[model samples]
Target: MDQKIPYDDYQLPVVFLPSYESPPAWIPPQERIQHPDYNNELTQFLPRTVVLKKPPGAQLGFNIRGGKASQLGIFISKVVPDSDAHRAGLQEGDQVLSVNEVDFQDIEHSRAVEILKSAREILMRVRFFPYNYQRQKERTVH
Candidate 1:
């Protein structure tokens, strides 16, 4: 004789499973997201405004290079330590976009230098774009 077990008498182990909602099909995968910081673009550069006040007969404490002659924008070549420029967050290789509202994008190297030296209070808009500067240097060298 065969014995049959009752369904109600059987014990089932309790299970707790984590549930995840699937992302919408319209949404792109996270792997597709573009990381902009890895690329070189004007937007990636850090733009800043630096104000330097020159004391009577005192130097601005930074040297600039590049301009129309070089087919490049004005770039800070040197920044004297503990000087007004350095203290104002100026660094070597920074491109000067403007000075006291005057555009430096296409100014001559000599004119740019003269403006920087003659100003009592220099307000400059600059950005750190070493990548472009390096590319320009390479082009000029070749």
Candidate 2:
């Protein structure tokens, strides 16, 4: 006759398995979990290209902050309502990745301002990153 084991007295066997798995070789380094720049949060806000034409003697109607002085990447500080930038989908707190194919990710404030002002037709690659922008702003303020 088999005796029934009490539920409280029963023991479960512990199994040990490898916790890490190598990612596929085809995956790009940036997309890999182990990459330094890998950030799952950023995937949700994919970079988008915004094309705008500046009317003669007219401002783009947007303000930009960040750069070497701020120790932050270029970010849109403001976007005027019904402006060219606003109509083109540019929003405040959006990070500017590049302008006219020129990397704005790491640039000087004056240089960035010059680039934006000099270009009549702008092609910018940007992504919404309000959290980062806010943190950077706070850091610069203090």
Candidate 3:
């Protein structure tokens, strides 16, 4: 690692130019681009409900990973191709907020899995935060 030289040892002239004009007015939260549902119209609508009807003895067709029990909620890590979950439009990175109308916001991972496994038909509510892989790759490449 390169050593950082302290600027205090150098004798540099200080330039102080004060601005006369006032700062710009603070924009409302709804008018800002970062605010949800404000300037984001092209993205997918979040808090979407996906209904998956699983036949008897059939699998849910999705893999879940991450999130600590009773802490952070689990995520849909993978959605099997041509599966029930995929057919129902479940995407990766969907934060599983609830299962069968029961909120699992602070639910344990094992308990959440139990709840999901026990249900024949699942009514899952998910928050969709879009991820652009191509854009991310381009940024990383540069």
Q: List the residue pairs that clash in candidate 3.
A: none
- Best by the TM-score measure: 2
Model 1 C-alpha lDDT per residue in residues 74-125, reported as the tens digit of each score: 8887899998789888887799999999999999888998888888999999
Ranking by TM-score: 2, 1, 3
TM per prediction: 0.65, 0.66, 0.59
Which regions of candidate 2 deviate over 4 angstroms? 1-44
**lDDT of residue 66 for candidate 2:** 85
Give per-residue lDDT, candidate 3, residue 3: 86
Report every candidate's CA lDDT: 0.80, 0.85, 0.70
Tens-digit lDDT string for candidate 2 (1-142):
9896776675777444688998755767556777654565656478999999987788988998888766678899889999989999999889999999999988987899999999989999999888889977876632
Q: lDDT winner among the candidates?
A: 2
Worst 10 residues of 3 by lDDT: 133-142
